[model samples]
Target: MKIVREARHRISELGKAAAYSKFGTDVARRILASPADSVVHKYVKTKGLEGSVRRLASESLPPGLYFAKLTIKQWEKHRGKPFRLLQGSSVVYGNEVEPPARGFPLEYRNIVVTSSDVTEFKLDINAPYELKIGRGAFTTPQQVKYDAQYGVKQYGDVFYSLRGNTVNPKKLLITFPGFGPSTSRISYAVSYLKDIKEADLRDTMMVCFQDRYLAAGSYMMVDSAGRSLYERVWSVLDGLRSEHNIDESQMLFFGASKGGSIAINYAKDFPQAHLLLAVPQMNLPYYFNKPFFRDNLFRNNAIRSSEQPESLLRQYFAEGRKIDYFYTNSDELSNHSLIELAHDVPNLTKYRVDGGHSAVARAALPSMLGIMRNFLHGAKNKTFRCENIRSYARGGNVLAQARVDNQASKIRGANWYLEGSLGRTKFMHLLTEHSYQFLKFTSDSQVLAAAYDPIEAMSGLTALEANGSRWTSSLPEPLTRGPKQSPGAVLSFDELVLTSTSPREYVVLDGDTHGKYRYRSYEVDPAGDTMEVHFVKDAALSVDTMLEANGKNRTSYVAVVEPLANWNLADLVALRFVIKAGAERLRIVLHDSSKRQMAMALLSQVDWKNSQVVAASPTQPEANGTSSAALHEKEALLSNAR
Candidate 1:
């Protein structure tokens, strides 16, 4: 036994000498110079690759040599591990042995890869399998599973292309595609693969889902039963987690346009996942009205009525989940409702980019990746601060003074806007200005100030009022009231008189009301009747009617007015009227001769005492019907007509 041990030791020593001679002195230097905690040492110890290491010299030690030496059982053990350290071995082996060019065939584990052309390869995975490829390889293998009923259909293809070493990946990124089937699935996978490389996310798994098209060539995720496609998506993700043993906390969902809508919807299920959306259609009702989705509007509307991203976001916030939004300043795909939804969701992080809707993804990619990295590494919430906001009313104008301190490294400038019960206004350009004096003339009782960085576009509203009273950041408090002033000129309507006459030019307020000056109230069931018009006999000859809303129907008032032949009131700035109502809010709308809405305003408690109807100019018609822009033009037209 001693003689045999000596012979074996001699042979091992001779083999080591041969390896040293073949690989040169670099092998010894590398082993001696390597730190104990280095990846090479760790891979060697954990993988039990001491023999492989002893056989290889530093100069000839091919990339991924240790992984290449792993047996079937050993490889299965490290299947889900991060690929950063072992990815180099994916290339061909450098020594006498020639590695498989096509890499590990799926057939080795009940999976098959078939290729019509060498360029594009189709993979049939009997069960879920891990796929690892080089950094920029275009031959992406998408897993296509067969559904028993759907027999060879493409519906089961909505899954991610798994990359990297499957052994305990650091981050898992799931991407959702935009509307329609414009690009192939391979291109989408390649684009995200490049993004992963650019971010240097070493131990990462990428997931990309294909949007299925309907018979009408429209992207439809909702079934006939009004159920969302997110259910299937969640099921697939759950399967992936179970099969590959992925950590749920390290997941992220990203998409643009319609894909953004899906991401927002999926975010409700995975509250622990970090959501990233670009130019997302938050309101499906608004999206249904678009030209592309017009044909299926009614069906889509039914599905949208049940579930909306805005409502889902509220639920997500309730569960302590946050979302990251990337939108363009001039996105035609987004409407006022979508923007308002993004603005109101306090937990959502918004990033605004310049250019059209399609450019948002390209422009915001770098910053989006950085945020994902920080989130994966358990970084704290990154936000700026706006302090010392002093607001006071000066006559009809409210002036505000504040300072914005940028705490984030990526944000260079900030934009400011005012949000009130009336509505949000356009964001003012305050990218460089820190100390700003924003002046706006309005009758809104309360207003909340907000500031956002241009780069990341994450915004924060003023939580503290001018009086130093603390309020919720999500729901800001109103501004303080100013000194009261005398009332303006009032225009009073005639009393409600009932008269029976033939060829009635004006409709009687008691019962017979038709043609122009026909008033309708939505508060009553059978409208336009005698009982609908309430009469009050007093010194002021006032009228009182209850305006109550029930369920989906809102209280409204509509009055038809006849065109004046020669009368002119172009010089008048506003027409004021007295009103008293128990309801907290009301909307006053004015229509032209063609029944087209010309102007409108939101009346609150402040406007109840002195309700006014002001005409708006052509350029500023949306200024809550306060005044008109073409005042001189109207004056000239009135003089010439008279």
Candidate 2:
């Protein structure tokens, strides 16, 4: 019996070997003799990430295994054939029923998933042709037609992991994009559209504030009234919170430039709303400051502004009083004036950056987004960004001197380095960017005098008081006219007096104290010649280091010019300087959103620490403060960025 079994096994093995030999020979011969199909040639290489990775190493190989001569096209072809196309409902009874007749015949479309299925069914897009398996109709013309013509036909499967239950929806980050005057004209256009499915951000619930009257093609301003227009949309948001299941506590407000101003004003008026202001406008004075007679649009409307410029501006200015601006170092339009107003009002929080008007967008986008998420969800301990003069000055090869401009004489100084050259042109660029008024010296005169425009008083704009207030004796019109003198000796006789006519405000700029100095003499002639006396202003002038002339004499000043509502912030960080006297009299106060004082102190001499100041007075300018220990923490706080 064993011998008979062995004989059968041998016979079976020989038969298997013969079959394999024949199959191998046929495949080899076909490869060697037949011309390759164009489809196969085209599939010679792969594409995309999967193809690239596969070419580098096969999934089946060990970590160190070597892959050789593998083409990208060949590997990608493994996924050949388009995604499955489904037609007609897969319901059990769907195949048995006849499609109802109508203007368009009721029909069904089908999708094939597997290779075997594709082979069994064929796609014939010919006229009036029916797809038949046996003979019974399976689909309706309307259903099939809709699939072919209207449905999202080309996109692959979109899987959404439903996060945060419907009972408690996740916080909605409403980012209001700031378009120019022409674009943000209406409520619906500028709002984030809810129907776009092309991007993953589709779920973000973004609303754009676009120009309603003028399309994106025509750049124009809407003159009807931006405030009223925005209020309508804001009312919609209120409805969403009250009527719908919106997570009201999780709503975040974001804006830049004009939009920033709107966000801040809206939040200030509606303190109950959970909104994070990212680089809010310093003030709304910009719109009225520039003359506008061009066409402005409203809802399905158009109007020219030649008739009511003053009245329209008056309305706009009234709205400006309601906002609490938080700007940054990069804000060229409203940084200086915003910071000035911040000192007067406690609600404002200011930040500083190194970029232009878009600095907050560029530097603080991620941080602002995170904070907004927290604020909307009722998260606690949310922190914000503040300005860092030392770091900013380092970027422009300049120095920063900060002081408390209150009536007290408390002032301190520190040295800083701005990144750029202190050459003549660069200095002027910094001035314009920061809105620093140029002291018309007529020539390169050491004695610099700054003039002022009366309108500056209305806007809270401040510059050094006229040079007339800081001189004791008459000197040459331009210091260049006088003979050169020693670094310490007086070259020209000049009087120095400090006065504040607009308001009793302290000069807020770099280099106000006497402890640190880059150069020794106030009016020094480094290359000495025969000169009698050099006239000098009070050493306490508020001149930014970057704006300081780069001659042999490097003496700078910090004058308490009239207070301003807003000034360019980008220019402030670009300045740096060293303190030569009055380091003990410096004080900085940090305020909260309620127009209430939160923190105060003398400016820190440390590089980057959480510095605080004690309220030397029991009450602040607004009659709100406490008697607390004077503390200075030398660290960066987002809350102080403005």
Candidate 3:
């Protein structure tokens, strides 16, 4: 156990060390100069006698030559006006405001800036300097001396690097790494090309950047100097493409969390830019309440008034953004981000992988690599899913077969990784001898396995347990795999489809929600017309809407979707209730556009052994335009529960 933990720690260290090694971006082009010695910043130019005093690193005035004010202020006055920086007494020097008459500061005094700009302001003393600036969002480095004391290097501005073959490549993969432990160093998430050996990428360029802001790092597109990190990233990409003559179709952006946000934002304007993002927070300002972010990054005027790529995702997707978004099914916040925005993504691929937020990378990275390899080799689009993992008892061992839906594609080579609760990893290339294949393993400990197939798509982490009961699930119809053969139907952002959904089902809510985040992922609130549903714990769905029964309480997880108050659903509506596995029964009340209950249906879990009906006939509408259906408690999926 100790060895396993120690191994993980060592691997982590190696990852950090990688930044300073061969994988490091070229730092020769520094965006913001490393803080120079003996420099004071953020001195306010005051119009009056006594203004707000700004202090420097070393406060004691040990007798210095002449005072040179850094004169830091935003260039725009309509955007914002100017302020004053005072040393001791105001000595006018043109419209530059007044500085202490030269050669006077031989004693202890902090620098002063007249005017209130609550953003991060810096002050230092040569003999005491003045700072003058107007209102505008800006960013400055935290005290360099303090950062250096911890042996952590810090860069104050957005920095990026472009490196790779840049020759004859199939696609250029732009990787945006997630947040680092600190914003001090430039972060690089895993670069797929480094591990790839395909002939196509031997000449493609990989670009990455640093989060110029602090704490959870940067907002990706905004820098403190009021520069558009968004425009800059695009410009860099355009330059590279122009220089290399690469087509737009051959570009891809990859990132998760913070990196995911940037990757999504960068490709917004460019419809051809493909995105592979995992568990990304759609809104940047959402994290501002955290002390670190609030103190260092969000408070700046530049950040507050900057062009937010925050919620523009809906607009981008509305204008045809091809995004492959991945999120852990159990993570409510990330999932909610998707539910709130523009509906019906043009070509969006969603993966409801197992585990929490941290586990997204494990699923996304391997899948990303496979997609990259596919693009390089000109492979068809394919997605492999572990549709089921059931425990089959043979002798005293519980054998499990992970039914992988390969979409009937030809498999060239497949590799699988298995890890036990103790952190032991095993690899295999098991061949499918029959339509159903079971991997044999029997133990009291927990185990997870991933079939890392290097195809157009792959599966996320799946777990198996020993001595667990077995169950079977039956689909009502053939599952649709969106390819050239069958048409794929997409549910819009405004559409009321959660998780795995079919085209035969649809619903209309009463109202719309704009910029309101009142409910968490665990809370199911169908307030007014908009539906806000969240899973309790491990429940989640991506592409489908069918739900299996829970042995304890299928109704324990309640979802309330709002209904229209005056529109009839008959003209455009399809609805049904289907349950599998353990759900005892489910009762749904039919509603007219006027929000009146007309009929009801009760669905029970399929009892394959008895071959019994799992669905109930809808009750006839009541004469008063309202109907009620009741189910016995013992046989109910949701009898009295709301």
**Ten contiguous residues minimizing lDDT sum, candidate 2:** 423-432
Off by over 4 Å in 2: 1-172, 180-227, 245-249, 282-326, 330-332, 340-349, 376-642
Candidate closer to the true structure by TM-score (higher is better), 1 or 3: 3
Assess the local accuracy of residue 423 in candidate 2 as a C-alpha lDDT between 0 and 100: 16
Write model 3 residue lDDT over 296-350, tens digit each, in one string.
4434445555444435566665665666666653454344434322233555544
Question: Per-residue lDDT of 215-257 in model 2, one digit per residue for the tens?
Answer: 2211112311211233444565564455445554445555565
Cα lDDT tens digits, model 1, 187-298, are 2221243445523445666665554322111223553223455667678777666666766677888777767777777666566787877777655654453332332332
Against the correct fold, how does model 2 do in TM-score? 0.29
Assess the local accuracy of residue 170 in candidate 1 as a C-alpha lDDT between 0 and 100.
Answer: 61
What CA root-mean-square deviation does each model show from the true structure?
24.3, 31.1, 21.2
TM-score of 3: 0.42
Ranking by TM-score: 3, 1, 2
The alpha-carbon root-mean-square deviation between model 3 and the true structure, to one decimal in Å, is 21.2
lDDT of each: 0.37, 0.26, 0.37
Candidate achieving higher TM-score, 1 or 2? 1
TM-score for each model: 0.39, 0.29, 0.42
